[model samples]
Target: MAKDAVLVLGATGRIGRLLQLCPPEGLALRLQARRAQAAAGKPDAGWRLFDPLEDPAALARAATGAAAVLCLAGPVPGRGAGEMADHIRLGEAAVRAGAGAGARVLLASSAAVYGAGSGLLAEDAPLHPASAYGAAKAEMEARAAALGAELGVPVCSLRIGNTAGFDAILGGWRPGFSLDRFADGATPRRSYIGARSLAQVLGALLQRPALPPALNVAQPGTVEMAALLQAAGLPFAARPAPGTAIPEVALDVSRLQALLPVPLAPADAAQLAAEWAGLEPQLRQEQSRR
Candidate 1:
């Protein structure tokens, strides 16, 4: 049988940008961006330009023959309800338009869905989102899961942790950056996953026969913010952690590991920093081959 063609929404953003590697052994990527302008300055890498909100026909056309759809296009935090509803709207429209029998849809969700939960978070954890972003994701999961049941389509909400390079510390680094050092002389530790590993997780899920309704995506262990900076060989001043600062946010990936061909291993600061720095070089290589 032929491999499934995966339709990737938000194909130009942080996670979708690396699909050029085509991590999955046999599957093909149907990359979709909101518009051509979002993918400017790059080669015509066959990006399907259309907003799921404005052009269901075009988005459906892009999803044609795709057995899996990965929706990564949506607003970040600090947005209004209208913006947060984009993911929900996109999910209903896309599924209505092109949900083939046995098709599976994966929506980009956040670890923020777990809120201020303590200890390792699992998919079954009750949500008490501390921020608007977290609450939005929780609602997205519930609504999408219901939509999936109604449509006879399988929808999985990926509760993803902080992706390396995109996290607050490394992604927002500057010469005079100040890190929150807690009373224990340690920086805030959060669940972290390398970009390549995340891609691999996606590939693994795409290859699966059936997926759980919700899954946590992350490396096995958490890493400290300051350690990531040190591994990147950057300097920063430390400030005493505020009372509001969170010391750690860990995700339980035991569910994820059981389904993968190879279980995810614990991560180190150096390995993660290298993964972020390597993105550009790999992109250049991909460009050269093109």
Candidate 2:
């Protein structure tokens, strides 16, 4: 059988690059970025230029004939107003394009939408976004969900947890980068997933006929920052940041596990950290230059 085509926005981003490297079997991928240069050397047939804010038509064109639309385009934290507006516009365009193309839409959301709170955060957890970035993501989720409903298209807002990337997780042990601690000076716990696991989960989501309105994508176990650092055999200091008190956020992945592949346990995260230790020297050099 011919493979279904899927459209991926932000095709050159961190997650996008991972999906490209390990795409789901039996799916043809169409990757969209702001410019062709952004996807240089990638397969030309699958690459296209699309600016959601400036060129909605182009985005729609990219979405045409796609079985699913994975919207991953958004501004990072601390971006200016124009960039934030663009991020909002991108979300709008994604739903419109996906609905028009008769494709399922998956919006990549963040765990920050749950705000600071202790205990397992389910998909229906109260949304009390603590920061502007979190608030923006919450708004995006709401808008996308509404638009998908209005257009009669299926949508899934995936609230992703702290993803342990090579640089962030391994390099976290170095000085100047401290982990968060509670009032008792104990390292806070969080649910985390590695990049490879995240990719597998996303691939599974794409194959589903229908999905829950929202789901928390995370690992099966909660990991303490101190334990993770210790397992990596690195010295680390924990300090409380000056801010309004917030509870440690832990995501409930029961729904995710039921639908997707089994996620890595907390011990697996520590093991992965140890495996990546050799890259710490290079990561530190890169961090110092930055």
lDDT of each: 0.82, 0.75
Predicted structure 1: lDDT: 0.82
Which numbered prediction scores highest in lDDT against the true structure?
A: 1
Candidate 2 residue-wise lDDT, 179-269, digit = tens: 7677777676677776666777788888888899898988877667676667766677667845664536688888887886554465365
User: Can you give the lDDT of residue 26 in candidate 1?
Assistant: 71
Give a tens-digit lDDT track for model 1, residues 192-270.
Answer: 9987888888898887878899999999999999899999998999999888788899999999989899998897889
Stretches off by above 4 angstroms in model 1 are: 38-44, 98-102, 281-290
Worst 10 residues of 1 by lDDT: 94-103
